[model samples]
Target: MQGIIHLWSLDATEPHELTTETLGQAQILGCGSVLHLLRTLSWVRTKQNRIAESSTKLWLVSRNAVGLERMQAQSPDSSRQDSSTRDSLAIAQAPLWGLGKVIALEHAELWGGMIDNPEVADVLVEIGAAIVSGEKEDQVAYRDGQRYVARLVKSDPLAFDGTSLSTENSYLITGGLGTLGLKVARWMIDQGVRYLVLTGRGVPSIEAQRRLDQLEEAGATIMVANADVSDGARMTRLFQEIEEKMPSLRGVIHAAGVLDKEILTKQDWGRFRRAIAAKVEGSWHLHTLTRAMPLDFFVCFSSTASLLGGLRLGSDAAAFMDTLAHLRHFMGLPGSSIDWTMWADDGMSLPSQEDGKFEDNDWGGSDKLAEYTMAPGIGLRILGTLMRKADTAADAVQVVVLPKDLSYLQGFYGDRIPPPLLSELYRSESVQPSGSSDFMEELEKIPVEKKRDHLATHIQSQLNRVLGFAPSQTMDLQKGFFDLGMDSLMAVEIKNRLQTSLGCKLPTTLAFKYSTPSLLIDYIATQILALESPEGIVTESKRAANEPEEILNKVKRLSEEDLEALIDEKVRF
Candidate 1:
């Protein structure tokens, strides 16, 4: 069954399982569902940039006439490059995946607005029915055999006369509706995102739906996606659905996890398996799914238990989990340093009470159980990293999350690699030197002449701020007032500053070579020149390459100028 359960997903779509019910898509003659349609549809828009390979222009805000005009105007290729742009007349816009939760939604009903070209607008308006339904009939056939139904639910930025994008972005809460999960979801909604997806082990109850209803009325696009994170197949399937259904997925914060703590000598074997499934294997599965995507970011929630490799799960559990976390980091799960997974006490699982005061655990004075378990900031930081690491709206980087700050609740579990391994992280790969040797110190003293050559630049820090220039740009400064025009003065000032700073009055022509600050810095450091020195042996030593055969060979080599010329054939650059 373990093999059979490798993959499974609730979001999996089958032809037989249609939407059957239009939850909120078409309510009360198109007004109620407009916001539902666009705000819940997930997608990512990519625009190739002449400058950056990953740059993309997302159609996130252009629902109003003026906004649409600007979006179209600024587009790199918005001309008649393709008639389909206008020919389509209507587009079935999906939900912007990363949009968090909508804070507001407003509409305009039939109050005619001005269009730059009234004739073109009239033509588009005249064919609206055909564009929405008549043409889409061949594609989006319904149970009743209808075409793409008449639905116009697009969101634009604030101040535009169309649907407004919540001031923030999109957010996904994998364990939405749970104690910690629900709180996190609500927090995101309050942050002004346009959409929120909630996933859990089960369907959200009526109470959860009521909360969502209130949130929706307040202008939030909310959804419920359920799956147990430990289920590898289900998780993989969920990721695929996100690609097809909600392409705008920025990143996932794996807040859904399980825990089992008992003495190693006393805990059952099944306890160990379940814990591994939740803490380690689940992390691996999420890590794998994220790797297959060009994601914004990904973070695995780890416990402080894994950090200390605490004895509760004993040495084996600690070693496995710590190694797993390190592997996760190696796979590019975000951060330059190994992040420690810490937690708050409230999120930890405990026994439910039976009509009585909460029974205290053995070693408790205060309620340290949750502080010992809830992964603090792991969820939020993963979310933050994904949102932050989004290189372009089109390409998102993945990250890992560990709770270090919440260690008061409980300490970590793992074989803490000693500082000895840390010290040798970047050691020499060639020769094995003495244990006490400082190879780095010896390497650093190789002398400037042996260093690599590089581009040099010079910058003049102005007495007055450069006003509009950034720190990396050059600033020209001259003594008193210059008799020359701006361009000439700049060149002269640059030359003098380089001379003063370097203490070597270089050729005026060299000023052109080191015009940039970065170039000037390179000029200062990367200086190289090779000088041929005689190779000789020192002192009385008994070693090979020193015996009579070697000495005689060296003497012969010195006499042979032809041998020297033969060796000079190679150039290293």
Candidate 2:
């Protein structure tokens, strides 16, 4: 079979057959099962060679995993502009969608697709047709018995007439001492907001204090509360203080989050919990505390990692905020979640040079696709747009806000083509260049003595592109990759670039094992020599002797199913 479908259910005892009624409204839950399944799938891909073959596709099915506009039968003379276009969102499954995006990027060959069913209609038939249709649309959601595909369309900031912040009402901003918080505070002041309550885990730094003072000087009454949003007692106390001293809470901006970056193999529960502490738990506290209040708007600042997974950003956990926003809207509350790309001035999200300014290159070579970093001015304008639309557009609670053209992001994927989800935003129809064959032919034309040098130069050029080094600058062949400030994402990029160029199946931990350019050169040279060997005789002998550790690594990375498969094969033999 070309495809294998795996169905995930909350109640495992339930039969695998489809049902007529919807399962239930989406909820905000933990990620224990989600993480387990992701870990298993990751291992399966790494260990099972057949599963990773180009012809085989792996599909994951989830219920109520995505939030989409519910379809209504169009009337002849009436327009459908109802506020209840969405029923509920499965916030608990946000991690699956977030991580799935990353998987689609990292393993496009084995990726079948992600299908979210509402369970209200012929779920089996819809899923079967989706898989067999040979379409590039990987992210699909069914709502009200209608099929809907996700799209990342461009929205103009000017299209939204900005909302006015009342001078008499108080607004609470979590993580208010950080860069984004202060920027929003400044914007609020500009919008004529007079009362502001800003909360953070600790006392503000000198810079934060300076910004706070600036806001106070602008004729706004500001309250700086040292409280962690994740702590229920602390959040309650802060709300009490606001009740006693400040004006009635009119709005809330949930901007609290912590960044945790690691691959699945390296991730632990502690890291995952830290990543979701402020994003999920803190948002929950805010939701429960303010559910009774008649707020004008409730905004949550989410990352693009939730929508389009970032490399090693723990995007799965980060996606909970999106679901939380949807949950609020489902309850008829004024809620909106803004999935923001990296901010130009936000140091917490983007790595910067010692001078505090971004490098001349795009995103300092960490992410070539981040040319659309949201500037403070533009981001706040989008926030204003969201605030204005929160009441009228309840179904638009989850908004993926990115400015300008997004076609260049296609380069970020392994296929060098934008996923169907981004078709509306990315209109690039350029032909994909096939360079691996030409590269191999050039390698064959090179003399045997100069092959190593040629490969070295090519590897160095790719490394230079990743590291943002000038083309003329030479990287030390003996120096370690990590020592040159290369991160895990950079390592993955280098490995992917080489794998694509060389047309070889390199290990996922390629840079980690090789460590240095000189060492990597030797290993790659051997692979090239083996590929060019006569009758595949030298390839077999050299592979066994020179790459025993690779075999051992594969064995070490085996999953439970892999071990079971091995036992079955041994019994058959």
TM-score of candidate 2 versus the correct structure, residues matched by position: 0.74
Could you give candidate 1's per-residue lDDT for residues 1-573 as a string of tens digits? 000000011122221231213211211112122223322221111121111111111111211111121122222333322222232211111111001001010000000111221233432442353334532110110111111111112222112122112344344555565555555566566656656666677776776667777778878777667776667778778767665654366555555544333322223435544544443345446655655554444443333232222322222222223333333333445311112333344422211011112223221213323333435444444444334533332122222232234222111101111111112121222222222223224434654333222112123332111211233443333321111111111333344344434333333323233434444444444321121221211223334436988866776867467666656764422
Give candidate 2 regions above 4 Å deviation.
Answer: 1-9, 12-30, 44-58, 70-88, 118-133, 154-162, 311-314, 346-370, 414-416, 427-450, 467-469, 472-524, 528-573
Note the Cα lDDT for every prediction shown: 0.33, 0.65
Candidate 2 clashes: the total is: 0
Ten-residue stretch with the least lDDT total in model 1 = 100-109
What tens-digit string does per-residue lDDT give for candidate 2 at 404-471?
66654533443345666666666544433354556777998986546667778888888877766754
RMSD of 2: 13.2
Question: Which one wins on lDDT?
Answer: 2
